[model samples]
Target: MAPPVLVLCRLAPDTLAEFADRFRLLDFYASALPIHAFLAAVAADGDPPRVVLVFGGAPIRVGAELLDAVPSLRCIITISAGLNHIDLTECARRGVQVANAGGIYSADVADYAVGLLFDVLRHVSAGNRYVRRGLWTERGDFVPLGSRIGGKRVGIIGLGNIGSAVARRLEAFGCVVSYHSRRRKEDVPYAYFPSARELAASSDVLVVACALTAETRHIVDRGVLDALGERGVVVNVARGANVDEAELVRALADGRVAGAGLEVFENEPNMPPELMAMDNVVLTPHQAVFTPESMADMRRVVVANLEAFFAGEPLLTLVE
Candidate 1:
């Protein structure tokens, strides 16, 4: 009999059907019951799932409560590069293997990060809004002039795959790129600052591309924004909580920080009302990694990880 694999998020019908052919797929997204009760019922069944497939965007977290309910679970496969939603410590404690979508979306996310930065610095989105509102004829070229992208000092928050890719793209545009990470990367030629504050202090623009963790949460706060100063801009392609949203609002409102381009927010699908009125801010739904090409790559990586786990081979993208 095929091993049961519990699925926790919405997936395309074709993707689900592909998995269903090789394994018994337990559809958690379709379940009407609460997660705990749903898991309870699944556990009560004779054949419990030994694997759980999850993705980002869903509120479901794979932690102790969910882990405890599925005693048979030995593996977790997530179709996301960021593992913030998964409890790595708990998975380690239970001897459960966790595999993530490593480097699959790096190029796409980096491309989007650069796009966001350009939108902020060049007022691309704001100019579009101005034209769309028919203000150009009424105002007669009163739209604010945009800053040049070349020769700007850009500081990146993380130097991982995504961050590194951002740095490379920015470098090609004649932007001087520096970075702040947990540790200085020996392989990269970019200058490294030991702290975010110092990085912000020196940068013309700050691009946040770090992961979300206890330490990284609110890493960019009022102090960092103040350091970036009134002429500096911010572009966040990382998690929303990485920058203190309230502080950012205050900064933008008071003109302490110049502008922003944001993809994610502290509370997703709902953002602060103040941002809607700001012409300098460009907001996109969490779609930095949703290109069709990247989605196909993600599916391949996910399937490979699951195949490796079930076949008793080393995972292609183990968290550790």
Candidate 2:
């Protein structure tokens, strides 16, 4: 019998096909039963799955409750760069190995971040709406001028793979880049601020590209937004919780911050209704890494990590 693997989230058909017959996949994601009940049923079957496959975007959490329900689980493979949904602490306590997509989606996410910034700075989406509504023809030269991307001081939060990529892309556009991370990177050429507020104070554009954790939750609060001033733009491609959505909404409303480009929200699929009415704000569903190339690359990385785990080799993207 092939090794049994528990699948906890929906996967793309191409990704599922990659598994083929190598493992007997227990389709927990397709089941209607609640997660706990599903795990109980799997446990009662006397063939507890040793490996669990998960996706990062889903709200499903692999924490103590889930871990306790499946004692036989030895490994978890997530097809996303962000591991905020998974409980690394509990997984470590149980000695369960966890692997993620690593930097596979970094370039794609960076591109999306820059695109969002450009849209906000240049009022691209708002202008498109104006043209489509025939307002431009009705009222000639009435549209407000937009800020230029060139020569903007762009400050990036968490200068990791995605942030670094954003910096590089923005540099090509003649934007000056600086950063604020947990620590200043010795190898990086950009100036580093010790805190987000300081970075915002010095920046014309602030980009949030950090992971979501207790320390980072609402990291971009009112102080940071106020420091960015009325002419500054904020772009967040990271987890929604990384920024205080309420504070952001208020900032935009009061003109404390000029505008924002958000791809994620504090609540999934639901955002503050006020943001929808703002012409200066640009919003998108969390799809920074949804490109065809990134999807294929994600599938490859996930399969390679699973293969390595089953082969008793070191995981290709171990989360440690």
lDDT of 2 by residue, 118-205 (tens): 9998899999999899988898753578989999999999999999999999999999999999999999899999999999999999
Weakest 10 consecutive residues of candidate 2 by summed lDDT: 53-62
Candidate with maximal lDDT: 1
Model 2, 112: alpha-carbon shift in Å? 0.3
lDDT by residue (1-320, candidate 1, tens digit) is 98788888788887888878888888888788888788888888789988888876654788897888988899989888888889999999999999988998999999999999898888888888888989999888845789999999999999999999999999999999999999998999999999999999999999999999999999999999999999989999989999999999999999999999999999898999999999899999999988889978877887788888889999999999
State residue 36's C-alpha deviation in candidate 2, in Å: 1.7
Per-candidate TM-score against the hidden true structure: 0.97, 0.97
Alpha-carbon RMSD to native, per candidate: 1.2, 1.3
- List the global CA lDDT of all models: 0.91, 0.90
- lDDT at position 147, candidate 2: 87
Off by over 4 Å in 1: none
Please state the error at residue 302 of candidate 2 in Å: 1.0
Give the residue spans of candidate 2 off by over 4 A: 57-59
